[model samples]
Target: MPAPDLSVSATSAVRVAATVLWTGPDAPREIDAPIVAAVPDPRGWAAGLDVPARRDLADRVLTQLLAGEPVVVLEERGDWLRVVAPWQPSDLDPRGYPGWVPRAHVAQAAVPARTEAVVTVEAVRLEPDPGSRGDGLPSELTYATILPVLAETGTRVRVALPGGGSGWIDARACVVRPTGDGKHVEAGAVFTEARRFVGLPYLWGGMSAFGLDCSGLVHIAFRALGRIVPRDAHDQAEAAGRVPVGEARPGDLYFFARPEKSIHHVGFAAGPGSDGVLLHAPRTGEQVREEQMNADRRATLVDLAGRLAD
Candidate 1:
């Protein structure tokens, strides 16, 4: 069955595991068709893009929306929707991070229940329980995707979807908590979450477990622990408390930029001191890695690190 058309001025939620937010309707390339489809294959799309093609994404993409994340639809053009993700704060739009996404990737928002289940693992597939008329096949959910809890059996949990259907996920794959709990793990734990993706490939505008951009890594790490940070490096730098680099500790954010320029890169501080090591998803064609703060990085490293926690 076809998904209903998104109405302007209404709230919507992403229905895929992850969907790329393009800069504009014209931003996507032929190679990006797979990712813009109703059922996106983010991993396959990432694999198909060679180095040059991947690098080109920096200009074409804005950010990514995880399954069930809400967006405010502002305009519609053919197969595209201009929306703002209110959960992902940004200076670009007063409402939230603004971008263009395929209309087919989202559906009208559902009224959420009192409890929600947050994905804890890197990725998990959600399927319907036997004998239940659910929606389509199993859908992949990435780290930090949150869905309202509907029911729970011994080892499986039924969750509500934005598309007006339900699916079951392994109880072991997520943690159930009261809606709007606002709880968060300590800095050390946030760093631990970031460490788990060390070898993951870097994808521009990516925020899912399949791939991540520099700021997306930090954003999702904190989010998995129930903290909401800005969605871009420059905004994140401004939101966090500034700490002298010499006093930096684990979980602090390391931002990089030329003098008098906007911050372009961000990473997690892996140790203490001015030359502390970093764990981050580097540029295109590179994988997330932990490395010492080298000379080249030092020259551009912001003198005062951004501190989200101790």
Candidate 2:
């Protein structure tokens, strides 16, 4: 029998391709590809659109893929209805693979409340020793809490260092805004929201909005609206639903390894740049901040996992 093909999609980026990543197999059965064409529909990706638009989308996907992106194919409706996308592509991708081509498969993240909307900063909880820990630091960032706050449209919630353990500004003075428009929050909002829970207390296997672990915080952030995502970090990695991190959006989940095993910890990536600074929940004594996540982290977590999760 022939191997089944995976699906992928083009994120917000303009450049996307549809080159080869690799074949299917366990262990070393991985490959990389670029996006070809992007479509908001879930069924008629690169294929649905006209040649002109498809060509433009294809060129971009090629560049990114050749650049060593983790692209993959999702599904196919006959040969004409093929859906291609990056590995673990952002669930929020304007078009995740193809089913969403017509804007189906609704976004997983929830829309926060409108009343009492506010933008605030909460710290991330980290393990005592960033590198090592006494209780065997979690395999992945488990909890990064999210304050019970909301924002108004055009709300500007600013991000600032907590010099003395105080972080709350008026709606007008904030660095970002919060709303429930079903639209991806603006950059400033994303940044602010991402950084909002830095220096927070970390918990073991936590999943609450008040005191979250890495994956827990991510789950709450989007769940506030209406999106249902994986509960823990490892599964969160799988939540990408088939797209790769290379094609991930700002609000997408970023999973890592614990130098131990499985899908371990996960975080929310901010914008492109592959900075490696993921938003996650730390250990009992850590803070929820965008710390320096270097290549070493990837070497431990992602590289070993093999493929970008779906």
Candidate 3:
């Protein structure tokens, strides 16, 4: 059978099999390790370093896989599992956005039964009790992190964690919505949500509101509207129908790829023409913001365009 058209909303219940670090959509490639041994030169060493070539699977993360987030498994190649990550949806690949993860990293045996809830806050601490305490879950949960609501106590909601555990999060911090609610979401709503992260730091491979890369920003914004776009710029460009630059509208995606001649960056079209603004997270250190695509930057934009909202 052909891979399902992932451009449309589709979901399955599965969890991260293990505390596995995410490799990109493609299969993993082994490289020489021990940075010092791999790259002997010290001058301009940092600039010349190939991070993936000298790192462990744990270090090359596109995103962290929580134990219970819903995922759609697409294919299996021996020890590796190609999966469609719900958080990182794609349009080009029918199997949903492929995340070439280890088979061991995907757990499908037992998914707890409970109501689904999405984290609404930027970051929320999971606690054993409703009140703040010194000992909470080891880390804070970011926005859009899914959880199974087991119980509701005063102003707090108990939820299942990725690993084998349960914790209480503020009731106000999460919103329970049906899986089918996003299909009819509005473009304005999508753009409105994108504007909230205007000052957030750009995190490569980040899909949550706390931090996200350029494409990550676009992915999350569309997700809010209940639509899923491809995870990378090039794939997204291919998946979406083409629209000339002159006809761009709000909620439309503006892809940027220059020198390399491939889509590497993407942003939301907020206005029209030269006075129009793009909402995007530019680079590693930059924050998500709305800015005019200057002539030089706009020159590199490809004619391709996509719309996630109906």
Candidate 4:
């Protein structure tokens, strides 16, 4: 589909009201248009997009947006729309995870009032009303899938869905995340939360519970614990304090990369000592699982480990 000319007037302010995908260039750029849809074009993506050096798995991917996440659209060229990401992608990528995304992946709409909620369960149904029997929404809300809180009932909270419309989700399945102190959260508790999605499929650039890449998994686990960390493995390595692998304990992160130049994959420590198993969301086609960081695996140099808390 062609891009919609939703360019706002100089005096009008704009914000994202839906969960759209960011498929822009690896370099920083921006646009002033909302996405049109969330369709993926595998052939087009591989043939046209400049692959980021840090992405581990080269599977078909799309960067997503939670409802009401703001973006600064900078420019439009052909069918691609350039925009600023709300989070950091990496140190090399400019200040706003700037990139070019297909115009088809977004549609312009009025920004709505919103609050953030994190998915607490593996998956939860989204209904049109505040009960299970209410008209069902099409998709399942997965663990760590952040949505904009709309209305709250005793046990359910209405949230704005990515595809549009409000859906009532069981409040028990999600927690309203508020901005505050996160340093008080313990590493063990964070690892416990990391253990929940033990069998999800790995996705490139995904950051939600529905499917997540290695760094995305790490990012979400910390976010669930209320501490927001960098979005990619390399950046996380720089931001968090590190511990030598031999001295690593539970709740520490095991970082893996080839030639030891940059951090690519990350796994949370789930066991103790040299015999510990690291829980991680591995690459494409692999389900998130625990792997014993024994002799052979560590040959890739699971040499560096990090602690979220210094």
Candidate 5:
């Protein structure tokens, strides 16, 4: 079947648990078919690949989009869609982070009018109401996924999916709030949220609890608290206020780069008095971890840290 002719500027919602945004349509390998499919299984995709294969994904995978997230359609190729995700800010495009994702992973739908709920756990099951027709909804939703709340009952909340139909999740698994609610979140709270993914594996361009890249870790952590930061390290550094390393505070961002080079990595400062403890998703083969700022890391550490306004 042909994909619908979604005009430029049309808004669509991601309908999969985590859709891999590829560098281009030809970037995905045969083994990556599952992840690029309409009903994606991220865990299955990851589990099937070994360390080397997983690391190789960096060459093609640009980023990831969680279920129900909004994207503005820019163009459509044979089986891929070029879209801008305004929620994930990046200097690459003024509109938002620019990327290509499988067209099947997103759909045009009416933006629901209701309070939004953000998934707060690693993953939560979405169950259909008794005898309700399934709409190919994902069985699990990853953290930071936002959807409109349609109805609520004790211990369960029904959410309207972007592709249509509603699914129920544990009421306790999400936090309901008005869309675009702006509130000051303490740096300590942001640090606390980031610490939750201490041991998650590093995936290039990843942005969910399933996996995360350096900037993605910072992005999602801040997002979980209703704060939206840039989706990449350089943009984040460019946008945040600079703070002297000696005065870095907990939850402050630590950007790393070689002399005269672009910012390539980011992490949270674990500071009581700027002792230089850092928590970050290090590299493709490593897991997110915390370590004291060693000499090697200091060599590339930016002199000034980044602090987002409260």
Candidate 6:
């Protein structure tokens, strides 16, 4: 699927899924998580997804290419996605951005044909909204979107999306440009650099645990170190591109949800291990601390959470 021409500004972070969702006919449904990426359905059933959802809908769609249910997907503008699922009505416009994508079980697609296997992975693209404070990157940039890159042999290493799907790239004809400082997300640097704020108080809407919200900690900690991230749980949920939580290194951002996986809160990925531990500013009058990532503990609230960022 080819993407439509849409305008984007520098400083925005844009993330693409390996697979995409198209607009559905008209079935109204909602998935879990704070930030949602969805496409509209002409009939009305849109494919919805959230990080907090059971299947991690966004991942399922992009990585697997198919949302578990029977649905159609459209490649929206560059870095944008859409959905078309059952229960949607035909009166809708599948071409427009109906907003949030829904949650769903997705099916994985087989590897691409040998002809399309030619490719290269570059630095992740973080697209923020237009006029973002990203310093020099696009405001709507997410992780990497197989943009057109030229290979030394004169062949184009066309980029696909984290959304799944490949295209051809010309080695010489296509020009691949470098964008953003990439400082906020140092590839080799684990989030360990952000652990300095531990013991700060947990405040509502607070940035440094001196009263911080889940996403607040992420924003403040990274920003303090010259790294920029999104505000709010939803925004952060779409931030820093995608990395398996299990594979997360220190300094990585960790999103948490109530038992519902609603993306209600977020935390810093302190270290790795099944201990499921994360660092955050505990709530009001509390201090920042490294708490267990116990699924049950996170539900009813655990280890006195805190706010971490701006």
TM-score for all models, in order of appearance: 0.93, 0.37, 0.68, 0.69, 0.93, 0.36
- C-alpha-based local distance difference test score of model 2: 0.35
Using TM-score, give the best candidate's number: 5
C-alpha lDDT of all candidate models, in order? 0.83, 0.35, 0.58, 0.58, 0.82, 0.36
Steric clash pairs (candidate 3) = 17-105, 17-106, 17-107, 90-230, 182-226
Give residue 217's lDDT in candidate 1 (0 to 100): 94
Q: Evaluated with lDDT, which candidate comes out highest?
A: 1
- TM-score of the candidate numbered 5? 0.93
Q: Write model 6 residue lDDT over 1-310, tens digit each, in one string.
A: 1111111111111222322332331222343221233432211112132123322322232111211112334434443335443211122343321222333222222222222221112122233223332322221111112232212344434342222323343343323433222233352242443455566444343332122445555654443333344445655554345555566655555665665555566667666633467776545445668877665544543222222222
lDDT of 2 by residue, 138-158 (tens): 111112211213323353321
| Count of clashing residue pairs in every prediction | 0, 100, 5, 19, 0, 127
Predict model 5's lDDT versus the native.
0.82
What is the descending TM-score order? 5, 1, 4, 3, 2, 6
Error of 1 at 246 (Å): 1.7
**Candidates 3 and 6 compared by lDDT, better number:** 3
Superior candidate under lDDT, 5 versus 6: 5
Give the per-residue lDDT of model 3 (tens digit) for 11-67.
433332122224543423333111122111112222233434323333455553443
TM-score, cand. 6: 0.36
- Could you give candidate 4's per-residue lDDT for residues 1-310 as a string of tens digits? 1111112111111122223344444432222121232433222232232334225334323454433334556788876677765443456455445555555444443233435577787667766544523322334555655555777877988776433556777889888754232346578887878777788666666666556777878877776655666777877777777777877777778888778366667888777765668888877667789888666457665566888743
